[model samples]
Target chain A: MPTAPAGTLYRGREGMWSWVAHRVTGVSIFFFLLVHVLDTSLVRVSPEAYNAVIGTYQTPIMGLGEAGLVAAIVFHAFNGLRIALVDFWSEGARYQRVMLWVVLGLLVVTMAGFLPRHLMNVFGAE
Target chain B: MTAVLENSTDTSGSESQAGAVSSFQVTLKIRRYNPEVASEPYWEEHTVTAHGTDRVLDALHKIKWELDGSLTFRRSCAHGVCGSDAMRINGRNRLACKTLLKDINPDKPITVEAIKGLPVLKDLVVDMEPFFASYREIMPFLITSGNEPSRENIQSQADRDRFDDTTKCILCAACTSSCPVFWTDGQYFGPAAIVNAHRFIFDSRDQGGTQRLEVLNDKEGVWRCRTTFNCTEACPRGIEVTKAIQEVKRAMITRAF
Candidate 1:
């Protein structure tokens, strides 16, 4: 287990961390897409069966899961855009930390908006 | 005559040592070949006097000037910019003049050899025609469909800043030589060429992004990079070579959308 990185970091940069997060989010979104495709394909079984599966997704508990999915998608999209910017642009490295904070901020804000709706559905009458 | 005089001067002790500061003994185990003489290449040792400040280029010059005039090697500019002096010194590819004695080894002898993964032309010079052919096949220049600039074409400073880092490549083939895929598959667009492609693909003034991406989307294109980061490590100009390749990959995926 050679844990040693081959090169020194460039002034405590977060580019590597952002890169790892992008990969994780990419894989998560891919699996979610797969399950989404299968779930939508439930119409082949019957309209009733498909509605039941669709109905399960609208519940308060499922809303929390949906919120997590939204969080993953938001984080992935924002960070992916940052990576694309860094790749295409020259001064991309200079704003790498700023991009990280921006992505995190966007994730927090998206989760905040989703959680209120999710809790209202779960607790009722609020 | 100079060698004979210097040999006898060594007998005078301290005076010779002081005067000999301009030259010091070094053993060069150079790889040699002759169509008229040997069946295969063989090692030939030549003891040459080189200054301490002298690089491997100086040692080869000693061999060519004093010892054997028949020895062949390639050198131009006598500086690092030309990239013509690339050779394997002590089992690593680098420019001869760029490698100083203090950097390699001051005491032990230095081994000088031809650049690897290329056909040998003579002694130290390898054929770079194949290397250049790959570079040309990648279309290293900007190709645009838009009308020529009437005056100075307008592009935002921010857009110009996007591709500025990728434009610093000197086409030295240092990154290509340091790549493992280029060593295995000659058809693969190695890091240097792909970096150059990226330079134009992201350029705001360039309208040939689709055409260049079509060329790079081939099987032997940017996908061949295993993300080993060796090319990035070997880049002399400090280009983020892996990051450029990853950008091309991202473009391939996003363009699908």
Candidate 2:
């Protein structure tokens, strides 16, 4: 494809899009943190109640949900670092797109390592 | 050899202008739309005979006068000072009269469109009310509680030169519209606003640096800038927009410290 002249087309800035995605993920992780805090704070209520909350994770459906939560947290943290780099550093723009790919790679590797063990624990095979 | 070189206008050099026709041809692909007429905008092309020194404004005038009567645009100064001629030419924001035929390749067609992120009024004119509103929101002036100077207030040469580049802003809004953050969020103070704020912030003559910084410290102020540098790349006056934005950010942070 031929390159359009500078003002001809709106390329939809990568930096802006990346920052927006970071904000969204940060909000999501924040909500999950809130829920996790509530769930863990049940330990003060009763040991049995805490055990019941932990037992809910032994189901296959809940295990999948846990896997997704972990993925979201990991991706959000890695991409959050990328956003901070862009905000504070001079050379951050140079590696912005490369760091986005790195975030994706981390997301994939983390999901692969986490999902299987979570499923085994749910099914009682491990 | 000297005789051949002198007589040969072919691929060599010609003192007298050769093939430089008394009239040159230019094609202008202008984006057109009428809210009542069509659902979407379309391009209309006009071929005009232009002189070698003719600017894009001359070509637009030729089309408006000789070809199409409905073509609309804004131009106060035929020279580049008024800053009303800013528009997308061949894909970048530029003043129409400042762009000459010799500067751009005449063989390729020139595309003229309204400035980005603003409502298009007609052929090449854009509504500038929103741009000016943002400019005014920044309060582009000095404010101080101290009494007016009875005599000339003294300042060092370095202090006076601090905001020199920012003072050159013509309120053109070219830098603001070019910013990606400004395009996405209307609340953003934008580059031109920050540049104007810098004009007041660094002025030794003005005693409103803290007040201006407080205005810029709003949620939609300097924090909204993502440092894309598109504003710097797009400024016609060669102002270091991103550098000034960074300076403001540093000042804000240092003040907090």
Candidate 3:
């Protein structure tokens, strides 16, 4: 048997790309949740300690990071719904491409609406 | 190689040239590999003249018989029943015998390669041992309890219809190889294995549904499927592969509850 390489280079379409995105977002969200829980648990220690930890999230860098997290959540939610529909509905599989585009449209619209408001809250005069 | 018309005239014994056979040269860009000669697979081109209705299998036969003797592939019951000629055609897994040259863009060279995710034993033939091993692990056959009835096991039409689509699977491995998860992680049972499991699991006569579900409940089971739909698209038998996998997942969930 002749072996060119261990793994062949495969080009994936929208479905495959969506699955990759879903997994990536899932793992990112899991880690984000872990950090969120740890930071939230600081309130039990003391207000000063919680505030000190929360102060780091008030930075411009953290604001941009929050935006990326919001985008990941939006994509994961929309794509997760699409996967659910595909699993339950008989006709959902046929319109998967349409559903993906719809999810993308919704994601963009959501980010457009959310980013400005979120950034203003993060960088607003206090 | 350039396209050459081998037999431009109608050879079907039609005296009237009204529907004369039009022969055009087709270039097959086949991936060739010989362990004795080459360490890696390389592209080999062969130009064979074929009619509009000729399939990729016919072109391969023409190349093997006339152009190159060392060219190797598998084909049995060339009309697509035997499922021996499943390979990647133009980046999509398809049956070579079922794929018509005219259906694909004949002006361009048709690319033929072995199915992905499986080790190729020769030119287009892959080692199906791993694929069948997974299939066997799922226990594709019926496992009924109690004494065997003297008469045939009666099954309602609807009960039979529950698994009708999965019965179309010919163990071609097209759906399995097309799966990205299976390609990335070989431990995953793949779509074909799950589809086979669905067949027996849903069978009314089968008493092994619980055991089969337990087998698939492993870390590398149906949970690994991301519903990419590549298996559904790549299935040459038109089986609802993703749907079957989903049904199995639903069964697992139902059992859990």
- Clash pairs (backbone) in predicted model 1: A89-B162, A90-B162
Using DockQ as the measure, the top candidate is 3
Order candidates by lDDT, high to low: 3, 2, 1
Candidate with more favorable, higher TM-score: 1 or 2:
2
lDDT of 1 by residue, A1-126 (tens): 111111111211255456556777789889999989998899998989899988877776777777777888999898878766665665564466687799899889888888787777766774
Query: Candidate 2: how large is its RMSD?
Result: 8.3
Per-prediction DockQ comes to 0.03, 0.10, 0.32
Q: Please report how far candidate 2 places residue B20 from its true position, in Å.
A: 6.7
Query: Which runs in model 2 stand beyond 4 Å of their true positions?
Result: A1-8, A11-126, B1-23
Q: Candidate 2 lDDT, tens digit per residue, B125-196? A: 767877887778767876767676788778898998988888887766777877767766766888888998
TM-score of each predicted structure versus truth? 0.59, 0.66, 0.81
Between candidates 1 and 3, name the one with more favorable DockQ: 3
Interface residue Cα RMSD of candidate 2 after superposition? 9.2
Q: For residue B28, give model 3's deviation from the true position in Å.
A: 1.8
Best by TM-score: 3
Decide which is better by DockQ, 2 or 3: 3
Candidate 1, residues B129-227: lDDT per residue as tens digits?
667776676677767666766787678989998888788887667677656566657778788888888898898877778877888888998877655
